[model samples]
Structures are given as C-alpha cells and as structure tokens.
Target: MHHLFMVTLKTEQSKRKQAFFWINAMAPLTSVILGSILVYMTHAEKHGVQVIGHLKKGLNPPSVSELGFGSPYLMTAIKAGATIGIISLAEGVAVGRSFAMYKNYHIDGNKEMIAFGMMNLVGSLTSCYLTTGPFSRTAVNFNAGCKTAASNIVMATAVMMTLLFLTPLFHYTPLVVLASIIIAAMLGLIDYGGIIHLWTIDKFDFFVSISAFLGVVFGSVEIGLIIAVTISMLRLLLTLSRPRTYALGNIPNSITYRSIEQYPAAANVPGMLILRIDAPIYFANTSYLRERISRWIYEEEDRLKSAGETSLHYVILDMSAVSSIDASGIHMLEEVRKNVDRRGLQLALANPGSEVMKKLDKSKMIEKIGEEWMYLTVAEAVGACNFMLHSCKSTSAALTNPAAVEPNTYDYV
Candidate 1:
C-alpha cells in the first residue's frame, strides 16, 4: 500500500487525499466492471471459450443434496472466502491508521474496525470477498483535499458508464491478459527490499516478514495472518526484553549532551553516571532495567578503580524519555533503591513527567528516596554534585592554607 501510494502521486497532502478518495472508490468499481467484462469476453473469444470449456469439466452446479453442505471442498472454499475477508479488513484498518499517523490525525481503531467488518460482511454476501480501504487510495485521499464522502458517488457513476457503454470493447480480451494483470498486481505487493530493510533495522520484523511470506506460500492464508500477528506480539516482547537504553554524557564543545554510544568523548561527571532508558517502563521490561542498572554500576565502579579514581557514587536514571511506568516497574524501582542504598550510592531521577511523578508518589518512592534526591533536570543534578565537590575542596583548602603559608619553594625537594 505504501509503495502504491508513493508511486501514484506527488507529495502534497491535499492532492494525495483527493486522489485517494477517487481511487479507493474507483478501484473496486473497476474490478467489478472488469470482472463483468471478462465474463462477457469469455463467451466471445476463442481462448476464453476454451478456458470456459475446461471450467465446465466436472463443474456441475451443486445438486440440492444435504451432502453438498458437508463436502470438504465446499468447506475449503468457505474458509478461503473468510480468509480473504479478514485480510482485506485488517489491511484496510492498518493502512488507514498508518495514514492517519502520517497526517498527524487520530483514527478511532474500533470505529474503523467496525466499518471494515461491515464492508467485508456486505461484500462477502454480495459475491465479493472482504474488501477494505486500500492504502494507495487512502494515501491519495490523504494527499488530496477530500473532506466529504461524496467521492464514492462519482465513482459508482463512472463504473456504471463503463459497464453500460464500454462492455463491447473488452469482449475480445484474452484470459491470459487478465492473468498477467493479476500476476503483476501480486508482484507489486511483494516487498523484497522491505524484507531486507526490516532485517537490517530489526531482526524480529525480518523474522515476521519471512514467516508471513512463507506461511502464505506453503500454508493457508489464515496461517499466514496468524503467524504475522504472533510474530508481531513476540517482537514486542523481545524489544521489552532488552530495551534501548543509553549511557549519556555532556558533549565537550556543545551545550547538549548525547548518548555515550553515539559520542564516547562526551564528558560524564566524575562520581556520577547517567543512564537513559528510552521506553515506557512496564512489567515486561522491569527486570531488564534492573539488570541494566546493576551491570552498569558494577562496570562503572570497576572502570573507576582501574583508573585509580574514586568510584561513581551517584547513578542518575534519566526518565525524561519515559512516558509511563507500571506496577512492576515501581517494584523494580524499590529494589534498585534498596540496592543503591546498601552500596552507599545515590540514585536520582531526572525529568519525570507529571503522571510518572504521581505514580512515584503513590508508590511512596519519592518519600523513601527523599525530595532532595529527585532532580527536575540533568543540570540540576550535576550542579548538586558539583556543589558537594566544591564544598569538600573548600574545607580541605582551609585546613591546608596556614600550614603551606607562602615562600615554600625551597622545601619542595
């Protein structure tokens, strides 16, 4: 759908929307008219006649026998029809929502689902498999300035004209031509590069793409969908299992700090460590976060020891990127606090959102850690640590000032 959308139109949102509105309505109408034309052409052409003659082999319209309802072949056909309906509806909804996201609009998934389901139900009963909104058409609509539902009316009129006036022109169209057209359509749907892209960017999605493609080839369409959905859910679990959390620090020549992985030379405060988890804290990822913090602290201490420097005593979990936290995350937080306290290391928070703060409050995390420990910003935490360092230096200076009072150059040896 995305490829279709990209190929069919320019980048303008309004133009895309208008084109989508027209095409979405027109495509199906075109398909129906084309089907009728093919049916007519079958009677007129020699090859079509030959194909029809072959189709007539053992093709007796079902007799009114109770056995007809119980036939496995009939069951398979019914299942196939259901599969097509589901695919169409699911594709329609997903494509619709994706476009809505691109346009920064909100689509009610349930409402869209209802519309899709009803459309399929109607299509199925009317001798059409389930049909949903096509992404190409929707993308065109998104690019176009279609604000109303009137486009479909025009589409229906155009289809009527084609059926009434243009039917005879297509009477000699070969069966092989239609087969080629369908084969090309299927080829267009295949995304070999998309599979490779997914493999490079996300291994799990690559697995899904492969699983889905193979399932369709070797198994039933329903199996393909099931595998696709299951793979998607597993991918979510895999992501949460080891979420992308970065160790961040200040860039030397810039005001902004960056992920240490991206900029290793960035200055991290002495005796302090910054860990940035770029995901919502949930039950699925709570253990991963706990393990990450534990490993990071141990490694940081080891590195400091190797350098003959004071070990980092403060670990800041930068929650600015975190949007939400769950109960399991809260439990993990409590455990982290206890462990940090045991090691005489401080754990601090930075830029927790209001809702997250409220969750922390309800969990009694703020009270347990103390208000001074919670920092609103990374700079505030750095300033606090710097102040403590400066105060210690000032006290040392006061103690040593009188003992080393002036003119001690010759005593150095």
Candidate 2:
C-alpha cells in the first residue's frame, strides 16, 4: 500500500501532500482499526495470531530511589551509558541537521547537544531509558508538514491519553499490524537515489555509504557505525599526511603567482623557483613536504639544464597559505634551507605569518637566513633576486671583457 500510494500519486503539490499524509498517518491508523475488527469478529486465537493479551494500567510511578551508583557494575554502567549516549546524540544531530537544512532553518549543533544531554539526564531520574529522535518518526513528522516541535507535544499528549484511557482499546491489537506500521514508516527512509548520486559524484563517498549499508545489513548497527566513522577518520588522516604542494609561476604581465599546473599560462621566473604549500605545516606532513619540495627543485633544475638556461640560483617559498607550523615543521624548513645551501642556491621566504615569524626568530633561523631575504610578497622576492643576478652578471662582464666601455649596458638576458 505504501509503494502503491507513492507510485500512483500525481505530480501536483496537493496530491503529494495527500500521499504523505496517507502513508505517514492514515495508513497506519487504518491498519490498526482493521486489525482490531479482525480480532473482534473472528476467533483469532485458533488462527495462531498473537494479540495484545494484557496491558498494565495508569502512568509510570516514580523511581528516584532506584538510582544505581555502586561498585564494579557502576563503572561498567557509566562506560556503556556514555558510549550509547554519544552514538544516540550523533544520530539525533544528523537527523535534525538534515531536516533543518531542508526547511531552511539554522540549528546550533552545540546547543542541540546540550539540550539532548540535559533531557537524557532528567529522563534517567524519571525512570526513562535513553531517548533519541528516531529517523523513521522524524521522517513521518516532516512529511506531515509539521510547522514546529508543537507536533511532538501533540504526539506526547496523545500517547499520554492512550496510556491513561485507551489501554483497553488496544487489547485486541494484532502484533502483525503494529509490525506492518513500523515497516511501512521505515520504507520511506531507504534512499537508493542518494546512493546513486554519491556514486556519480565521488567513488570514495559511495564506498563509505555502501560500507555502512552492508555493515548494518550483514553485521549489527554498532558495527556499521564503527565502520563508517573509521573510514571517515582514515580519509581525513590521509589528506593531512599528503597535503597538496604546488609549484607557483608568475602570471605574464602581472605580479600574481599561481599554481603552474592549474594556470598553464603562468610563466616561471628566470634563475628562480617559487613553491607554495597549501595547508598548515604540521608534524604529520613535514616529511612529505620536505620530499615534495626536494622533488620540485630537482625537476626544475633538470628542466633548466635541458633548456640551456641560467641555472636556478634562488628558491622563494610562498608561505601565505601556511597559517601555522610546529617544531617538526620548523626543523623541516631548516633542513630544506641547508639542502638548498648545499646546492649553491639561495633560499627565501615570502609572507610568513606572525606566528611563523616569531618561531623562526626564537629559533634564530631568521638571523642565519638574513632578514633581507624575507620579503612581503613573492613578486618582491623575485625582483630582489633578479636585481642581484643582474648586478653579478654586469660585474663579471666588466671584469672579463675590459674592452666593453659601459658595464651597466651589458645585457644579462
């Protein structure tokens, strides 16, 4: 019936609303009424069908004195409670955020976490088990065009009234009917289209989604949650371990520097190499950065040698994107500087942030590298290197070729 309603509904908004209402509300209600009638009109017991045989009357009594906080089991209970509490909170927040986005509203995640934590704390005192917003019920509420959380209030009131007065009415309710209602509500949560969309956009994201799905289907819900979270953390770690490093080149007729791979039209400066790091310099990535920078230097030198151009004499690091660095990162930079010096090339830094400046100053590296080598911009650093190279060439020309009348007139290009 749920599938039929979904398929037969028209494209009009009113028809969609009717479908949502029927599948989410009326269908379950109708199933319960029919089940009650079947049990009343027939000998349901002889058919081996189970019915609600009995129900306790009245509201739950207070259990304030039942609080347990003793010995070995107390610590175990705390650990288990915390684990389940975190998992439930994560699920509830994800569901809330999704609906909030769809409804064009904002939700403060931290505030939501606090609210959930407080609710659970109070609920425990009141003899309630761990409570969370179930996705199936949330989907039904959303589909019913609920304007606010007042719907939940209405639902709770209805449930309270049912427990207070309608307990006898549910005595003949069949277990199969209740199961049908649950199955119908849960069917709407299966989103095959979303999986296909993920596959088309990103294979890794599709893998994660499918892994979670299969894990839940084959293993337990806990296993699926663990697998999904583990995969996500691994992906984050992989990105940090291999952060992107780009060889920057100057845009023709402009001082702007960009990645040569991204902007193929950008040209490399003569007798100088510029490199950019695109993430924070941290201990985890320092080794990778060192090797990557070394590779860029060797590749640039090979290209210069093949072209029969002036050998690379200066390497300017564009540090604008490196917002922070650690001790290992600083050590890596020192090692890079030493390697460049061994290769008879000058190493310069451009636009180092205040934090990096302070660290370098404290480490006494700035004085060793000379404050004059650090420039405000990549363009300024390249220009200074070019001027120094031109001066050296002019002096060499004057010394080697004394017949030349004008030393400044010697062309270094």
**Best-performing candidate as measured by TM-score:** 2
Candidate 1 global TM-score: 0.62
Best by lDDT: 2
| Model 2 spans > 4 angstroms off | 1-24, 43-53, 68-72, 102-104, 190-193, 216-223, 402-413
Instruction: List candidate 1 stretches off by more than 4 Å.
Output: 1-88, 94-177, 188-225, 253-255, 392-413
Please give, for residues 267-315, the per-residue lDDT of candidate 2 as tens digits.
Answer: 8899999998878898999999999999999999999999999899999
lDDT by residue for model 1 (1-413), tens: 32233323323232347544555434433543555466574555543332222221221243233334667599788888677766776776666655565457887878987877776555544444346776445543433344456866765675567656665555444444444333333444455776788889989778887897788668845567679888888877787777888788988866566788888798777888888888889998898889988988888889998998866778888899889998998999999989998988888888898989999999898999878888888878777876876787788887889565456778887
In order of appearance, the predictions have TM-scores of 0.62, 0.87
